[model samples]
Target: MGAHRRKGDGAGTVPVGGGRDRYFDALRALALVRVVTYHAFGWAWAGLVFPSMGIMFALAGTLMARSLERPAVTVLRDRIRRLLPPFWFWGAFVVLAMLVHGWMPGWQIVYWVVPLGDPPGNAWGEQAWEVLWYLRTYLWFVLLSPPLLWLFRRAPVAVLGLSLAPVLVLTFVWQPPDDRFGTGLWDLSTYLCCWLVGFAHREGVLRRLPPVAVALLSVAALGYGGWYALAHQAEYGGYDLDDDPLAQAFWSAGFVTPLMYAKARFGFDLAGLARFRRLDRLVTVFNARAVTVYLWHEIALVLAVPLIDRCWEVPAFEAHLPLESQWFMFGVAWVLIGAFVLLCGWVEDVAARKPPRLVPGARPATPAARMAP
Candidate 1:
């Protein structure tokens, strides 16, 4: 979530009007960390632990709604401008790698630039680039936000209440085709309600809701989502919510609702973080390089494997480090991720029209006011 001001705002929705909204900033940082951890380890339970995609979309939706206060065209342009450069910079490497591996070119290749649909990839690039699905879905959301926000504002409660209908309809009435278009449709529907909840949060609709009602609704959604995921694990091959969009949608709704509402209703407190300068700075860096982190994490993990294998050959590393452990790989992945952040993260600064830095949130030689972009 970008930022909005409200009295009594503390944990989840710190007002960005005065400064950075540390709460949402931390959520995004944690979500990005979870995404990398899940992919690195393939933990089925991780989805239940944290529905990162839903949370990310909700955060983005909140930002989008806040941005829509300006001209829609301008907002859209700024968003695309912010998104595409980083993507193109990342895609250039992946696309070039795919071409070197003999990936044939076709019109679908255009998606590498615009990503209106899923970008084509060779087998070697699949794992590294499959995460592009989120980018594609986010692009779609950005494209659709103008109309969605319009309808959402007219009857915020009613529209937000019924926002899950598209996913429900897609789940039961008709299944999407097993193609790129279907993939996009399923992803869009799966996260639509979360996105709308973001809108509600931005406009204070969530803040105004009765606490008991919000809690009950969240419980119902979580209960059903959990039950559905568990019951259908066999059919889906595992209980990962990502494998089942309906469950993910419901689970994310349940999980994210109270969180968005709690900022105003209960003031989930995070102000103590100010006492830990280094920890606070890490959170700031995470938010600043979110795109860079997301784009490079898979490759980082992939690189971690061989590096770990080489380490196994070194007796010192082999005896001292748990080189065989996935946890160890997770650690190595972050190290590589940090390196990538240093090398390529400047694209984000350029996109944001800020002075480029090797790492975000590093103390400047001279003290200067830190402001949220």
Candidate 2:
């Protein structure tokens, strides 16, 4: 515990307070936009997003490792608060969208709240309760980190080495069963590996590697992910339903790790972007309310689809659009996404406001710190 605490202080370099990590927040914003564009356009135009999303998850894994320094219970409580409140609020928006569109009866509202809106024929229509997949998986990752850290104390390098070796072999060799949920739904297991990799990162395994090591690895991983997605586009559509275990393993081990390794070391650079501080501040506000944005974006999509149908002769957004007009679809999706982001931003304060600041002396922790004797 003592040494780990030092790691928490030393290995942990990011500052606290603003709850704003500009680079990482931009990553999240980028990933969500990619998801929106893909679902809107349904093609490889969003090729880069898959690896980008992996980077965000690995960074999250790092965040969980460091946050464990605080009382786990307090941290867990805040995690639930920050994640669920906005989810609940946006959930209501989804229900309202269904009601407005007359897609379902008003009395069936409870199903939406419970997140079991599986229609008889199409299960994918289940709205996933508005980006709750990431939140739920992230919560699981946070819950599981303490034990992973406990393992880190005994055999850090060997554990990572062995885990990576088998997964690598399996990724190139096996295709998972698509009919059943086993390999199809990698769930927390896949992302868990990435999270633990972050813990290994904190253990100083990665620091010893040369700068070009991760960069070269990132390029290799990106190439593999692109070719893999292209090879299986017919069966998997660039990804294996986000459920296939084997594909999930490839994503985490082959695709995700390289991105994490790259992102941690400033492997990429952006230039001439400094004149946009005001633009960045607005984006900062958008990120601060990220929970709200994730919650509402889907509902906005659901509503926008029908409204577009009423206004235009073309009723279909996903199925029958001309191949040449993909950019038009992309623009529409961004407009809807932007609208939802702003609407949710207005409601963010109500949900994401941290538990009231310690009112003077009545706060939970006292000012004086006593060393562990």
Residue lDDT tens for model 2, 1-373: 1000000000112324433455555555566565665555555444344643455566666676667778888766766556655556666655555556555545445433432231111123344343444554565666667777778758876665554444444455654443223221234444555666677555556665676765576466456645665567676544532423334444445556654555445533222233476656544544555555455555555665565555456556335654235565456656775676565554445444644321111214444543334
Q: Highest lDDT, which number? A: 1
Over 1-373, each residue of candidate 1 has an lDDT whose tens digit, in order, gives 0000000000123364666777788888888888888887778898888888888888888888888889999988988888889899999998888889989879888998898887888889877887888887888999999999999989999998887888889889998787787888888888899899889988889989999999999999999999998998887777888888888889999999988898756766477777899999998888888888988888898899999999878899988998878898999999999999999999988987889999888766644455533
The alpha-carbon lDDT assigned to residue 7 of candidate 2 equals 4
TM-score of each prediction? 0.93, 0.67
Off by over 4 Å in 2: 1-19, 48-50, 95-131, 162-185, 200-204, 212-245, 251-259, 262-274, 313-326, 346-348, 354-373
Model 2 score (lDDT)? 0.50
Candidate no. 2 TM-score: 0.67
| lDDT of model number 1 | 0.83
Candidate 2: worst-modelled 10 consecutive residues by lDDT: 1-10
lDDT of each: 0.83, 0.50
After the best TM-score superposition of candidate 1, give how far the Cα of residue 361 lies from its true spot, in angstroms.
Answer: 1.1
Error of 2 at 47 (Å): 3.8
